[model samples]
Target: MTEEPRLSAQDMIDRLSPVLSLRTRIRAVAALLAGVTGAVFMGTLWWTEPGPLPGRTHLAFALLTVFCLAWAAYGGWLLTRRIPLFATDQVIAAWIGLVASLATTAVVTVVAVQRGAGVGLPSAAGGVFVAVALALVVRAQARRAALLRRKHELTGREER
Candidate 1:
């Protein structure tokens, strides 16, 4: 069996992003679409709330806004770059998905508890799917970064 040629860290990083596999391309597209949707929703929520903003509410609004903004920004960046957009960026995007999921679930749970209503299964499933897909992308990128770093350290030569 023949081993595949090693790729340099820079090369690997470059290769990690841009023009991905079809499945990954789908994930990236989904991330962007969800990011935009979440950001818009959160932005409107933050803007339209009535009454004075209290400390905790303000903080919550800030964090949620930042997270969702990051989600959208990362997605746009990825699309503009047309590359894999790196692992750290992917990690950020994944958190966006997970947060979107958790936040939606939490809201539904809180409302259901208050109103004695049932849960929304479809949204929960969609969120979970987005989270898992982006997460897989993050894991793959982190793994690739680590492997490239280790190989570079051992070989003392960065192969392209």
Candidate 2:
């Protein structure tokens, strides 16, 4: 009788945890939802009661968007190159990204306020709220990655 070959770590992961795959279908869907929601919010702001943004606002948003995209890409690369190593690195990266996002938001908010916008104490508080929410999301992603790794390990799969 012929025996079936054991699956490699990557193959096992692909079959057993499709959801944890890099830029998985679910993640793509989530990204789409987030992008659409953000677009709608920006559209609403642009169409109704559009406040004058500071000249630096566009540059700041662009830079932040780039930073976030780069971070996501790097995470994807890490997952592909070394799936076993991804969880720990991803957790650290997520925290760093959260901090960077918060700093960017705070600096831009302050700039906007200084540009004679009606932004005040409440706006600053809103920045804090946004930062907190971002941190929560990052932490959630990191936890998910860790859980997936643990699940894989518990299944007796050989680490690649």
Candidate 3:
């Protein structure tokens, strides 16, 4: 018997269909907008303030921004490969990004408080909001994927 082929990353992206269609483009756009807005807010706080931002705090914010951009960029890249793959990968990346942001925010908040920097509160809040938004976006994409799969199943049954 012939062995089943193992899928490479690019092959997987090529095989899966996107869960979100043109109707759901708004979700991707929202994710991008939220990511950019959070990045701008955190960047401003980190770079323009009078007192130096604590090293940990600066790094956390920077990582948060990078993850956001990565999520967006990955989603865009996946879209050209396969739509379903794009949705699946986007959800996975968003979840990882959220967790990383939350962990970083927690570490930075504790460090900033220890250093007597009260300004870290705003930063912490911003990080939390970004994490929450990312999580929500992932949930939305998952739901959309499920709906699409169901529709495809129904259509296939009718065709058969």
Candidate 4:
């Protein structure tokens, strides 16, 4: 019996297929773009006086901006490192959905709190829950699409 040599991480990277690398780099570009967009918007919105925006509104935007930029950086970093064994594209998409929803919820909750509505926080939480649930659904669909694509590539036949 012959024994095979173990491959190092660098060796694996060196052997990575051009197609996979291209795909990953595309995702990375998307993440970087999102980060840049968030930064631009945040800068434009907060650069000058808020113009009657309450304190809570400022906090909400700041939190949302932070989340947006952070996730974008994380996604780009993962793609650059080719670490998608766990953080797959579908997972990234879901995270994007969840993050956007959470930001929206933050704004809504702030408005609700400012209005003195005792039920606002719970309602905002419920909205976030729904958004996450929808993202999960999207993730499942994405997984299915990827599987179908792989199957097509392997069999040279498209599944109806």
Candidate 5:
């Protein structure tokens, strides 16, 4: 019997429909906007400081600005890319986001505690961030699993 041809990535994507849902696209736009806005605000504050800041403060500002720009770049890349391999990409991005959120929360909580400030507000905000990041992680994993299942089914059909 003649063997059937395997589907290429593009062929599989064409059959699978839209690469990203509207929600995901909206998230990308939001990330891009938030990152840009944060970077601009931080840069302006740093640039307009009337007095000389400590070296540590300067380093902190620079690091924050770079972090914002990195998120902006990631969002822009996500928006522009049309490849079908983003199921894995989304999973990776989601995990990175979760880790970042956790780290930021820990830092904020520690700083607030050390400064003799009430930890209530910081803890609440951190909880929210962690929750959202966790939700995204879950959604990304589920989406990736669904895609893999569909890919397997399609490949099996092609073999038949």
Candidate 6:
């Protein structure tokens, strides 16, 4: 009797987790980075200013920041939680998110200090970003380690 051929690690990974196309991955990463950066920059600059700003300026800043955050959230969802990205891609995305989150927090804190508004709206928003990004980073690392372990096990079995 002939034995059926076993699936390789790559094949198993394909079956277990469908891969996203390169273009999609790139777009997702870009959107996430740009959105986060824009939001942080706009929010920090707009919210920290002490003088009474015009209503239009407030509206513009608020609209722009919200739009950026929405895009960032969408891209983040695709790369980190919803879609099944490659282990390397996942790791990269997670790290990018962490860096962005750290930057956001830092900017917010600095602005708050400058404005003498300790732990205000900006701080709260930044805290949320850091917390979520930290969770995503931990999750991504765990998933990558798991994939590597599985690959090793499969390779060992194939050898046997």
Pick the lDDT winner.
5
Error of 2 at 111 (Å): 1.7
Q: Candidate 3's residue-wise lDDT over 39-121, tens digit each?
A: 77777776787877667767677787776676566545544543344246556656666666666666667776777887568
Number of clashes recorded per candidate: 4, 0, 4, 0, 0, 0
Candidate 6 per-residue lDDT over residues 1-160, each given as its tens digit: 9999999998987776635666776877888898899899989999798999966557667767876786687677666644444465566667777776776676667756866898678878988888988898899888887877786677753211
Off by over 4 Å in 5: 1-30, 54-60, 118-120, 156-160
- TM-score per prediction, in order, is 0.49, 0.42, 0.47, 0.56, 0.64, 0.50
Candidate 6 residue-wise lDDT at 26: 80
Better of 1 and 3 by lDDT: 1
- Candidate 5 whole-model C-alpha lDDT, 0 to 1: 0.79
- What candidate 1 gets wrong by more than 4 Å, as runs, is 1-18, 82-142, 146-160
**Most accurate candidate by TM-score:** 5
lDDT of 2 by residue, 1-24 (tens): 999999899998676653355554
Candidate 4 lDDT over 122-157, as tens digits, reads 575868676775868587667867877887788898
Model 4 ranges with Cα > 4 A deviation: 2-21, 50-53, 87-89, 113-129, 132-160
Ranking of all candidate structures by their lDDT, best first: 5, 6, 4, 1, 3, 2
Residue pairs that clash (backbone atoms under 3 angstroms), model 6: none
Off by over 4 Å in 3: 1-20, 78-82, 105-109, 112-160
lDDT of each: 0.66, 0.59, 0.65, 0.68, 0.79, 0.74
Estimate the Cα RMSD of every predicted model relative to the unseen true structure: 8.3, 7.5, 9.9, 8.3, 5.7, 9.1
